[model samples]
Target: MPPPRQSIAHLAERQFGVVTTGQLLTLGVEPSWIKRQVRHGPWNRLHRGVLVVHSGPVEWRTHAQAALLHAGRGAVLSHRAAGYQHGFLDSPPRVVDVSVPHARHVAGSPGVVLHRRRHLGAEGWAHLVNRLPTTCRPDTVLDLLTLARSDDDVISLLCAAVRARTLPAEIRDAVMRSPRMAHRRLVLEILEDVEGGAESALERRYRRDVERRHRLPRAQRQVQHRLGDGRRVRADAVYDGLGVRVELDGEVAHPGGRTDQDTWRDNAVLLERGDVTLRYRWRHVRVTPCSTAAQVVAALRSRGWRGTPRPCSADCPVT
Candidate 1:
């Protein structure tokens, strides 16, 4: 090797910089060396001392930069940033949020959102160690709930949170103890309605929108018609002898890594119950109740059960 790699830049190509003053000194790169590098366009200064080596695609460090700039010295990225890292949100947040322990609120910047919590639980908060835009899952869930626009939005966020087993008990407690949350009757109802697990919420939402809205008869959830110890496949919704079974189709229901797996499962359910099964989607349940009801009624009529969905204010808006 040529002279045994003398400097920090020589050691790492895309360096996030030395973690401390001591590391910088150990690397024999003084404050002058950093300044000279930046001045010569060898490194980009992200914060006071954190320098990133100029390289191909230095990553979208919006959150880390905001955290470093907003929280001053020792703030590691957490909450929404962490959520992003953990793959919770589908899109990156427009504003980078930083959590500082102090009570001072820094004036806002164009893309910086600073949060000061007096006491964020340190136990679970250590997940962000050495990670940019990192946050504990609990805090992330709470932030999503606070920021989500609609009940469906909240449901979507919570469903993900629940699936990840990251929805904290503290969040549940915070919702229950808050007097203000009581005013949001729909949110409260949805929150209370979340039982069993994330799959349960998906099932419940499908039942509420598809079965209850269309005046379809209630189908027993997770019913197993199979005999003892034989890995009974649970029907999502079972009408028993009423000639209808509603199979709530979620992503987990299809496991072959193919869309055809879903079709096969639906067909299997239908064939098992003499083709009386009605399948519904997770997202379109609320919005497409009319079409879903029409399908169910058509199925019922084919089985010699005459019934029509009553026209109501719930008639879907023409889209």
Candidate 2:
């Protein structure tokens, strides 16, 4: 029989000190040796057959490794767990998410969510990230899309995932792959806007809720202006000839001294052309869109814009 160090110990080192009873048996380990380790206090049982080699604290990675072991062959980290793994999500999920083949049955345990998917494998849909199986970048993004609670969540999720790793085309292809996915059309629409320069969710909301819904004058997107220093800058939304520019700020708008750079561009527009700029954040654009539309209308009118702001609906706050 092979020694424990040569077989089970090596696997544990690679898998965050986690090993399965099935794996240990395959490596020629006796059954009582596993039970004795658990009973002796050097090891702990995390699930039916999954064991952690150390008695120390169990971290997130260790929990994830244990969950995968319990799930057995052809199971992968998916949904929120995969999103965290792919860098698409901002934080780690409290519950570990795993997907197993629909035909394969695995009983669930506490703190682990098992997703039974029709086509589950390490094929194109999944990838090995840091020795753990996770859904591919695009598939992870898609899974989060279906799981989003609101339209804003969908937009934020798409923008975040797109900026983090996967290309816009990859997202679209994943959409095509899942024909009957929940919120498929909504995802496709948001994907289109993201590809068309709606880089942030706040910007997309401004276009849909404040501008289009209120019937505000069409604003050209990403209009370029050459500064006196010969450098070029692009404004988010511009009303050409009227000299009105609108800027949209998401939660993390100005980072790494971008505020100073933005001020310089605003000064350039104000000094060179005597134009006015309006800036809005998530609250102005998302929470109170009609009020935001009114403010935008007043700014455009002050700039000699003749068009009148139209109320989006009968109950719209805009007059």
Candidate 3:
């Protein structure tokens, strides 16, 4: 039979190089033996009762596993940690976030954020990803809502999730399931905007402050076009009932200058279809929204749209 040390190492391999003292003891490894390894050998203590089984390097997974084990059984990764684990977050978290049953009290550890969940046992929202127990993706989004420092932070997370291909229905259903969610309305509104193909805050700003506020006709989103060279492209927004298409250029896409692809789509798709499009950036939508709305109304009028654009307020200049 393999020795207790070998047994613990085997178990740690399955846990991203994390091993709990209870696990070592269960394998018949004495406390003194564990001490010797931590004191003078390859292992390093991550928390009070958790240790890294190897000495090469401790990555995010290792830290995550150590946090989970340190929090004991029935704990799962949550919030930003789960976001990173679920492949939506761009970077590893500075502090590992772990969620445990509200009734369970795990001692606080350095570099770990503990979230107590009331329904973590029979109705717990957890599953395995990359071999570590974590909150479900939608639930992770909800957890993030509670922890986000600002509205922009929340929006950034949701946009990142959308970019990572998380279904809107899934997040919406999660919101529905959580009736008492703190940011429910804001999240739902943003989700609707994003699902309507407003991929950036700039696009959403146009949809809200410019189009809706000015009473412009509802525009189709992500309108796809098949070009001459068989290249399929999608426009940002298109007015179907009226012959107007607006191409939103956000900051993230080619920040320095416009792409040739945009020109090709504009000429081949918009002009050929006899649709007028407006090009606007962050400043136009955010700084001079009324002027932007006025331009859109003029474009719509050029396309034979017999609609009057309303000023957003008494002081507004949309007309």
lDDT by candidate, in order shown: 0.57, 0.85, 0.83
Off by over 4 Å in 3: 1-5, 28-33, 55-57, 149-170, 189-200, 241-244, 249-260, 270-277, 281-283, 294-307, 313-317
Q: TM-score, each model?
A: 0.72, 0.85, 0.81
**By how many angstroms RMSD does model 3 differ from the true structure?**
3.6
What order do you get sorting by lDDT, best first?
2, 3, 1
Range of the 10 consecutive residues with the lowest summed lDDT in candidate 2: 249-258
- Per-residue lDDT, model 3, residue 144, is 86
| Residue pairs with clashing backbones, model 2 | none
Please identify which of the two predictions, 1 or 2, would achieve the higher lDDT against the true structure: 2
Per-residue error (Å), model 3, residue 300: 4.4
- Native-referenced Cα lDDT, model 1: 0.57
Q: Which candidate model has the greater TM-score, 1 or 2?
A: 2
Model 1 off-target regions past 4 Å?
1-28, 60-66, 73-79, 90-95, 104-111, 121-135, 167-170, 181-188, 197-205, 222-235, 248-258, 282-284, 304-309, 314-319
Query: What tens-digit string does per-residue lDDT give for candidate 2 at 234-313?
Result: 88899888888998867665543248777887888899878788878877887899998998888888878887677978
